[model samples]
Structures are given as structure tokens and as C-alpha cells.
Target: MICESFPVGPFQCNCVILACEETRTAVVFDPGDEADEILGSLARHQLKAVFLFHTHAHLDHIGATDLVRTKTGAAAGLHEEDMPLCENLHIQASLFGLPTPPTPPIDRFLKHGDSFSFGKEKVEVIHTPGHTPGSVSFHVPAFGLLTGDTLFAGSVGRTDLWGGSHPTLINSIQKRLLSFPDETAVLPGHGPRTTIGRERRSNPFLV
Candidate 1:
């Protein structure tokens, strides 16, 4: 497994690219913006993207979904609960005073325990809502966990946004995420990477 995560767009949301080294097949996650940069990275890596995935439908997380899918011809997937938010992307963007782009059609609605593979590598979709009604975390045991905005390095995602719930988010983190080995790296939608063990021991929101 090969993986890279970087920030994109004005909001600097974290975008990740993961591929199977042997097959060079990849998956793009949370392409918030800078489709060209993301595409460029794929080209430099010599990887073919087969899927685009979103953790939620927040404006900053799915802003470039349409463009990415167009450029890579990859099918997009999102949890069903976020469909309404995905459809209202324009409205959501407006709230942040940002311009909105058209959203791409979701090829699949991910559910808990759902799995997909590329080049023999598989990722499990863990439905861990709270940040949004449909928020999810992708766990690839060989690589690391792609945890959108749900859990950050020292903190956690805010529940003030649409469909967000504090208690629910905590519950999701405690049950769906912390169960992973403490050493499992946590790749979030923003900020630097941390590990489950670190967060479990000290994350202010969790501890």
C-alpha cells in the first residue's frame, strides 16, 4: 500500500491518494479542490484512479468531486445519509462565502462494513456519523484510517454544522474508531496525522 495526504483549496482540506504499489491502481479521497494538482499527483505516481470517495457531503470535502470524476472517470461514493447535503452543496458553499461547483453523481452509497478493493488492497467503510448524519471513516488495515473531519490530532470535528451532534460524534469515535490498534495512523481531513493510541490516550475531546 502507498499513500499520500495533502491539503487543498482555500480551506485547506486534506485530500488523500492511496494506491496499491504493484498494480498502481488508486482511490482519491476528499478531493476538496485543486483537481489539477490531484490529477498531477496521480500522473506523477503513475497510478490510475478507479474510485473517488467522500467521508461526508460538507462543502470543503466534496467540492472537487465532479471535476475529479470527470478527469479520472472514476466512480464516486458517499454514505446515503449525506445525499441531501451533497445535493445542497451550492447552498452549503454559500454559507462559507465560497463558490460552488456541480456535484457528481454518487455511484455507490457506502454502508458500515462495506468493502472495496483495488489491486488486491481493500478498505472497509465504517459508518461513523456525528460530524454529519452520514459521515464515515475508511479503514485499510494495511495502510491507515482515512478519518475525514471526524477526529483531528488533538481534538475532534465540530458538531455545530448541519446534522452534527456532539454526543453522537463522541460515541462514533469511541466505538467505531478507537477499536483499531492504537498504532493505526489517523489520516484526517485537516491537520497533521496522528495515531489512534495517541488520540486514545490524550485527545482532549476524547479523554
Candidate 2:
């Protein structure tokens, strides 16, 4: 598997592109903004995007969802619990005084335990809510964990937004994320990468 992550948009949301070297099929996580950049990455990698997966429906994480989907013909997937927020993109943008972009229709409803493959690599969905009711983390056993706004380098996600819950976020981190192998790489949505053990031992919120 080939992985690339970069910050995009005004908020600097981390967008990730994962591709299978053998088949050149890719899965884009959080196009966020900068459709041209995202598309260019795909072209540079010589990979075809087959799926666009969102960790949640937050404005920063989904700003260019429709644009990317339209450009690559990739199917957009998101947890069913976040549908309401996904549908209210305009309101979400309004809250931040940003212009509203067209909301993309969900091509697939993601759920806990759901698994999908791109070439020889597989991605498993772990429904880790709290930052948002439908927040999720993608686990690629051989690669790493994509903890979108869930667990960061020395902190955890903020649960002050719509459908966020502090207790639930903590529970998800402890029960769902911490259970992974200590060496598992944690690729969060907004900051530097860290391992499960590193977070367990030093993350201010988890420790």
C-alpha cells in the first residue's frame, strides 16, 4: 500500500490518499479542499480513485467532497449517523462564515466492521463517534489507522461540535482505538502521526 497525507483548505484538514501499488487503485480520505491538488495527486500517483471516504461531516473534512467525487467518479462513503450533518453543509459553512459548496450524495453508508478492498489492501471501518455522531476511524491492518479527528499526537478530538459527546469520545478512544496493537500507526486528521503505544503512554487526554 502507498500512503500520502497532506493538509488542505483554510483549516488545514489532513487529507489522505492510499493506493495499492499492484493495482493502482486508490481510496481518498477527506478531500477537504483544493480539489485540484487532490486530483493532481491522483494523477501524479497514476492511480485511479475508486472510493472517497469521510471520517465525519465536518465542514473542513468535506469541503471538496463533491468536486473530487465528480472528477474521479469515486463513490462517496460516510457513516449513516452523520447523514444529517452531511445534508446541512450550507449551515455548517454558515457557522464559520464560509461559502457553501454543493453537498455530495452518499454512495455508500459505512458502518462499524465494514470492510472494503483496493487491489490487495483492505480497509476496515471502526465507528468511533463523539467528535461527531458518525465519526469513524479506518484501520488498514498492514498499514495504519486513520483516526480522523479522533486521536491526535498528544491530544484527542474536541467534542464540542454538533452531536459531540465527551464521554462517548473517551469511550471510543479507550475501547475501540487503544485496543489496536501498540505499534499501530495512528494517522490523525489534523496533526503529526503517532503510534498507539505513544498515545497510550503520553497523550494528555488518554493518559
Candidate 3:
């Protein structure tokens, strides 16, 4: 398994590409922006996209989703509860003062425990809502976890915007995310990667 991460778009949302070195099959998690760079990188690695998944539908996390799917013929997936946010891309873009881009409808709606296999690698969907009613995280036992805008390195997602709620986000963290192993590598949406144990001990929100 091979994984790569790079920040994209104006908000610098982290876009991750995970692939199986043997099968060359891959998945793109949060193609926030810069379609050209994302596509170019995929080409460089000679990886074929199997699924395009998002942790949530915040504008910064989905700016390049439509473009990536169209170019790669990849099936797009999101948590069912976030369909509204996916459909409201334009509104979010406007609110965030970002340039409006064409957004695509989600082709697959994932439920908690639903699993996806791309090449030899596998990912399990964890419905860790609270950042938004539909926020989710992707967990790959062999690699790491892609946490979107939910749980961060030392901080957690703010629940003051949109469907966000402070209590809910905190609950999600304590119940859903904190259960993961201490060694699980956490790749977040907007910052450097860290481990579950690190955040558990130091995060103000968790402490």
C-alpha cells in the first residue's frame, strides 16, 4: 500500500491518494481543489481511481470532486446524511467567498461499517458525525485514517457552523474517534498528521 497527502485549494484542505502498489487501484479522499495537480499526480503514479470519497461536504473539501470524477470515471461516495451539503455546494462556496465550481451528485451513500476495497487495499467507513450531521472518516487498517475536517492533530472540528453543534462534535470525538487504537495515524483535512494517542493526551477539546 502506498499513500500520499498534499494540501489543496484556497483553504488548503488536505487531499489524500491511497493506492495498492500491486493492483494500481486507488481512491482519492477529498479532492478539495486543483484538479490539474490531483489528476497529474494520479497519472504520475499510474494509479486508477476506484472511489472518490469525502469526509464531509464543506466547500473547501469538495471543490474539485466533480472534475476528478469526470476525468477518472471514478464512482463518488459520501455519507447519506451529507447529501444536502453536497447539493448545496454553490451556497457554501458563496458563503466562504470561494469561486463557485460545478459540483457532482454523490453516486454512493455509505453507511457506518460499509467497506470498500480498491485493489488490494481496503477502507471501512466510520460514521463519526458532529462536524456536520454527515461527517465521516475513512479507516484503512494497513495505512492510516483520513479524518477530513473532523478530528485534527491537536484540535477537533468546530461545530459552530452549518449543522455543527459543539456538544455533538465533542460527543463524536469521545465516543467514536477516541476508541481507535493509540497508534492509528490520523491524516486530517487541513494540517499535519498525528497519532490518535498524541491527540488523546494533549488535545484541549478531549482533555
Candidate 4:
């Protein structure tokens, strides 16, 4: 398994690229922006993206979904609960004073406990709401977890946005995130990476 993550878009959302070295097959997670750059990275890695996944439909997270899909011929997926948010991409962007980008049609709907594989690597999808009703985290047990906006390095995601709930976000963290091994690495949607144990023991929001 090969994994790389970088920030993109005006909001600097983290876009992750995970590939199976053996098969050269990959999945792009949270393609927030910079479709050309993302494609370039994929090309450099000799990867053929099979799927483009969004942890939620937030504009900053799915900004380049259509462009990427159109270029890579990859299927796009998002949680069904975030469909409304996905459809309201333009509105969300406008709220942030950014130009609206086209929202791509979702090719598949992801749910809790769902899993997918590329060559020898497998990823598990865990539904974790509260940052947004459809926010999810992807766990690749051997590598790390791709936490959309649910859990940050030393803080949790903000709940003041549409469909966000503070209590629910906390619950999602305790139940979904804390359940993992303490040493498990966390690749959040934005900011630097951290370990589950670090956040569990010291994250002010969690502690």
C-alpha cells in the first residue's frame, strides 16, 4: 500500500491518494481542489484511480470531484446522507465567499461497515456524523485512518455548520474514533497528522 496526502483548494482541505503498489490501482479521498495537480500526482505514481471518495459533501472537500472524475474516468462516491449537501455545493461555496464549483453526480453511496479493496489493500468505511450528517472516516487498519472533519490533531471538528451537532460529534468520536488502537495514526481532512492515542489522551475536546 502506498499513501500520500496533501492540502488543496482555498480552504486547504487534505486530499489523500492511496494506491496498491502491486496493481497500480488507487483511490482518491477528498479531492477538494487542484484537479490538475491531483492528476499529476497520480500520474507520477503511475496510478490509475478507480474511485474518488468524499468523506462528506462539504464544498471544500469535493471541490474538484467532477473534474477529477471526468479526467480519470473514476467513479465518485459519497454517503447518501450528504447528498443534500453535495447538491448544495454552490450555496456552500457562496457562503464562504468562494466561487461555486460544479457538483459531480455520485456513482455510489457509502455506508458504515462497507469495505473496498485494491490489490492487497483493503479500506473500511465507518459512518461518523456530526461534523455534518454524512461525515465518514475510512480506516485502513494497517496504515491509518482517514478522518474527514470528524477528528483533528488536537481538536474536534466544529459543529456550528449546517446539520452539525456538538453532542453527536462527541459521541461519534468516543464511539467511532476511540475504539481504534491507541497507536493508530489519524489522517484528518485538514492540518497535521496525529495518533489516536495522542488525541485520546490530550485532545482538549476529547479529554
Name the runs in model 1 displaced over 4 angstroms: none
Task: Give lDDT: candidate 3, residue 27.
Answer: 92
> Candidate 3 lDDT (Cα, whole model)?
0.89
lDDT (0 to 1) per candidate = 0.92, 0.94, 0.89, 0.92
Model 2 alpha-carbon drift over 4 Å, by segment: none
Candidate 4 C-alpha lDDT tens digits along 1-207? 888899998889999999998999999999999999899999999999999988999988999999999999999989999999999988998888988888798999999999998777888999999999999999986689999899999999999999999999999999998999998999999999999999999999988
Clashes of each: 0, 0, 0, 0
* Candidate topping lDDT: 2
lDDT of 3 by residue, 12-48 (tens): 9999999999999999999989999999989999999
Q: List model 2 lDDT by residue over 134-167, tens digit each.
A: 9999998778999999889999899988899999
Listed in order, each prediction's TM-score against the native is 0.98, 0.98, 0.97, 0.98
Question: What value does the lDDT take at residue 10 in candidate 3?
Answer: 83
Return the clash pairs for model 3, or none.
Answer: none
| Candidate 3, residue 157: how far the Cα is off, in Å | 0.6
* Residue 22 miss distance in model 1 (angstroms): 0.7
